[model samples]
Target: MAPPRAEWLASSFACLLLYGFWGFLGKLALVRGLSSSQEAGLEKLGFFLTLPLILKPSATDPNAGPGLMERPKFALLAAYMSGVTAAAADFFYTRAMMKGDGGAVSAITASYPPVTMVLCATFMREKVTRNKLMGSFFTLLGAFFMARS
Candidate 1:
């Protein structure tokens, strides 16, 4: 039998919360004791360990196609760029948090989704619904208020 929609939604949301905390905690750990290169090495080691567990089933499955080694160079390039961007963002975020008020920095960072949505709408010709506009306005306002406090 299929799971209920609400059950799926709740489970997804819970997973998101857990994953978000996981990233945050990892960043905190990296910020605590390691230089960027050390942090990257540690993360790569963790990935090597964890990824194989997830990939093992697919590796054994006859229906699955060729492994990631068969993928084009551009795919690896894109993944590398993603990692670079994430590392840069984390470095800046940690700097901001350490230098300024965490609450204010968090508020400003939380405002990013609205700014991203606006940019996407402008550049990608994506539809900007009224509700989205209102949410963006409120997010900015809340961030502004938080920063002012």
Candidate 2:
């Protein structure tokens, strides 16, 4: 791995902290009788909050990046994919937790870097080097070992 910049390091830690809380608090909520449907409904607030930032007029902010405004077609498709997958995954995850699934089991099952590597190789013409394959293998292997315990 390359040396981390301060900004990147800070953001990474922030994400880790938030994600840690997300899993912990999400499971806790399930334990406390929060329904999966309610969890799914609450998650939509995040998407709603992002609408202004996403749909803001480029004229309003001259320094805006080439986001959805630049490509409406693909943006719509991507947004659809993101929304559907996130909603479905959140529903199933919360449902699983409600049924007594452990956080470690969820982490192991949701780890998809290896699947991503294979997909990129097949669909995106990306290189699949020996090291990359080995790395992915070891990652899943480690997760498997952790899960088996």
Worst 10 residues of 1 by lDDT: 22-31
Task: Put down candidate 1 lDDT per residue, 35-120, tens digits, no spaces.
Answer: 54565557567767998686665455655776677878887797899789777876666656545565677677657768779778
lDDT of 2 by residue, 10-59 (tens): 97888778777777777776677778777656656765887888675656
C-alpha lDDT score of every prediction, in listed order: 0.71, 0.74
Lowest summed lDDT window (length 10), candidate 2:
100-109
Residue 66 of model 2 has an lDDT of 71
What are the TM-scores, per candidate, against the unseen true structure?
0.57, 0.70
